[model samples]
Target: MLQRKTTKLINKHLLMSLVVVAFASTSLELAYAQKNQTATKKKSSDISLTSDDKIFLELREASKNNEASKAKDLGQKLSNYDIADYVAYFQIKPRLFDKGGAPRAETMADDAVDQFLKKYDGTALADRLRNDWLLVLGKRKDWPTFDREYAQFVLDDDTQVKCYALQSRLTKGESVNVLAAEVKNILLDSRYFGDACPDLVNSIYKANGFSKHEVATFSRMAVENNFETLANRFDVPDPMADIVRSARKSPEVAFRDFDKKAWRTSKENTAAAWGSVGQYLAKKLDPNGLKAFKMQHELGHHHLLTPETQEWKVRAALREGDWRIVKETIDHMTPSVRKRDPAWTYWHARAQKELGDESLAKESLQALSDQYHFYGQLAREDLGMKIHVPKRVAADESLVKQASSNKAFARAVRFYDMGLRFEGNREWNWELRNLSDKQLIAVAEHAKRIGLYDRAVNTADRTKLEHDFSLRYPTPFKESLAPIAGSIGLDTNWAYGLIRQESRFIMNARSHVGASGLMQVMPATAKYVAKKIGMNSFKPSQLDDMKVNLTLGSNYLNMVLQDLDGSWALASAAYNAGPGRPKMWREKLPRVVEGAIFAETIPFNETRGYVKNVLANASYYTAMSSNKTPSLKQNLGTVSPKASVLSELP
Candidate 1:
């Protein structure tokens, strides 16, 4: 956006440079933490920040660490900045955050919050601050004030806040039964057991809104999420609580106890406790869990299994090659849950075929073949058809100019330049809420033109009726990356596919777990790759270099691919979840399993999604890179139990 004769591109980085540096400096974890666009007249992605920009970043850091004194000092220094509200909000937020990291409403002692709310009214920052205040009020049971302000809370998207809203309703004498139903639906997220949610659940149980079975099932779910404290507080009555205790101590012991007469007193409660054990063991890829689940079915207790329990049973069945159980589990799922994943349909068909219902199996797969995704690709291959990419579709060029004039797009570009990805993404998404398919294409095209490679792909991907594969699977640094990939005897397009998924083509992207650069390579992995490739001058800092990241990433990827016998599904899983897991997961396979089945059953939720997406992206990249149609089944190939090779790799 700076005045210049030449235009430039603006792409967003994963995290701020300070966070990336801090993460890279201490990259020691073995597990992966699971978990942009373009524009303009235009702006450089690496645009230099003024002194005010430096102050903004420092204020953000101070806010994060709750350094109120430092943030206040810095906030005062940026009074004249165009977005001084940003600095002031940072100054005020630190005071609100408690030592446990939750904000308390009691911290708002003066008119600081009131003045800021009035000045920045209608802005996203104001809405965000209001949300924070609501959390604090809800925690304190300030229902009158909480109810009044909650109505004005713009993005009522926080689960805890929503739970608090329900709690407020109960305090205001709302019907406990209705509030309980809402609580059950909204409080499923177990990432954290924050204050309001536990209170709400306890109040619901105290009011007898939940039946005995519901209490046992809900308590079982709490234990599954490793919230033993909450489970105990639920006081799941005698025998079942004893079963839960046994199951939590050790899944192996729980499997043995399933045969005990006492554990079988109530079919529903026993199924709940037993299902909890099966779910936990399934995550660990233990086949014995499926054995315990089969006992549930024999005792006619399977009907009591919760949705989460039933879902994990499917994963356990596939790993153990129990085709009958796979078919039975899917058959028991509600129509809504069964249809939620195409994998269920695909596997249900496969299981039916194995169980002597070939015609019905073929009919089911034929239904799944037309869609475009990992399972759809496998279904097509099964039906004797090659997976074909849709013909490229484009929007008109004039829309680019229209997009360039849009205020949200301009600020998004600026925000990306300053490495404020959170703000940039918010601005970009706000404008995309109602864009038509072709308009989305237009925005994507403009984003691609200005070097917003990440946003171009993401925006183009949103279109249901039109698409530009070149924009969606762009090779931003292909000139350097392609040769590195090829030199290592790896597929360049697959590298592009992986990079596209890893960082959305950001050059200096760094994940929270210290996976850095274009490919999001972890520092330890980068160091190991460096040693393997004999790159004597390598330092972890060099991972941010375009060439270095691609080199190490491709090399590491090649090693996994080679060891896994070129199974893209396995390699992709290895890349995301470390080599040891897929190797162990693969070794547990009873026989040669379909690639789609292998991916669908990956125990780690993030790794499962990661493998499916990377292979799907590669399939499209293959079509774009060469005129020939691509086959994802070929990439996912067959996942078989193989012998040693990469067993020694980290």
Candidate 2:
């Protein structure tokens, strides 16, 4: 009798669960109708919490703190949960990743890993499992299983795994040239690739893949790419590697080292030695660098000039505004180096214009005007054209409705509301991955309607068939922004532009470094700005509020602008980095140069990109808001030494 009563209760609850999902489905339709619906409503709450949710939360915390035994106990209680796969994963994670006091991961059965991958298939959890499983396989030198599993791996960004895959291929007697090309790219890039890349190359060397000449070529590539530290590691035939090393440490010492070598018959060694010295001199922008090049030319060793030395020569000339020399150097540049960026294209045109070659300059400018970048905008200005934001592309309502109904995106919206932005983005991107161009626009519109401005912009950026300027350059939070910017004497469009880049209009967005809200004001910065502006009763929590964030952010921007002598370029750099850095960087330049050149030469990768994007974004916003094209050059002006400006603020 008790068993029958329990059965009836289970059936009643099952019916309730179905009704909840049905209600959620109906609410999603309402969400479609009201674009401004709170992202968290119905979807998460509709799924009634059970003991499993509590246990799962506890298990997650335990795993995070590495309380393996505690996690195991909590995880056991979640064995029958709807996301039991995740619980199982947490149960196994510590064993796989932990080094000290952990049991052998190789003991894990192949069926165990295969089961997780097979069940989860397309989920982020599966991708994570693959990574962990691959690591264990690599640790055990189990190449066969790795090879089999690697084919199904998505997100091929793990450099170590890539290196291991290459090792497996080599062990199978396969040529690594195809992957070697990829490796070379990783090596030459400015980003760190960790130990795996060097390890792979070392393995290749042991396998007799790299000849002395090949190693020398790689070393040169490293030096040219400004990866001097990496270049030092290459096992090139002695004195040449030594010269590359000395080039970074002391160009004078490198020149002395080159001078010590007697170059009568060894032309290759001579070229290597002289090229290293020349590169060092050019890198320092030493006045003697050009003289060193002339000396090499006089001695018929100009052919020894590599792309590195040639490019630095262009930078040095650009600093001095030596247009004739700039054009000559550019003309002499290798096609690969000359065509590396549109900056060179713009410079090529400028050089032609400076040298009284208007026709040639016009041709170069015309080619560059079609692009949509810093140089592209400048090129358009050079061609006497206005920079206009492209028209909005209207997505089909049916397509948008379909996108709104995407199960993954719906779940993502719920996750975002739960403050699980990482997971939410993963789900959101998974849905975006296979979408058609039109579908992409539709989803972007859907994301926009739901207040996911960042997702909207990113999605619109991916569409190849459609160009949507309004979607890409959205002006959100005007109600809070306009008054704050106006009262602070800041350009409303510029303030909006900076905020767009800073937080992507996410109201509660917090950066990894603890910047919060739409403006991404750091806690200390918030306090400082509030104090300076005489804002009493300021609380750090208030930084997350829209109005307070804009108020503090605009005041700080105005401060930097005033401090930096009203140069927007310097001010933008100061805003992203700090006030001190832009000041120091300005001191590095002895004379005035165009703000574009100043921006490009910034040493910090993040700050350099930040300044350009903010300025370009500001230009677009200005044009969009005012319905008149603003000159990007006028915004950039020139960045000069603080001393050059008489009676400037300290």
lDDT of each: 0.72, 0.67
In candidate 1 the C-alpha lDDT for residue 113 amounts to 75
TM-score of each: 0.82, 0.74
Q: Candidate 2: worst 10 consecutive residues by lDDT?
A: 16-25
- lDDT tens per residue, model 1, 69-165: 8998998998898777777888888888765677666745337877888897877778888877778778778888788878988768787889889
The ten-residue window of minimal lDDT in model 1 covers 21-30
Cα lDDT, model 2, residue 116: 77
Tens-place lDDT per residue, model 2, 251-320, is: 8877766676636535655665565576567555564555455445445433334555666666656766
Model 1 residue 137 lDDT score: 78
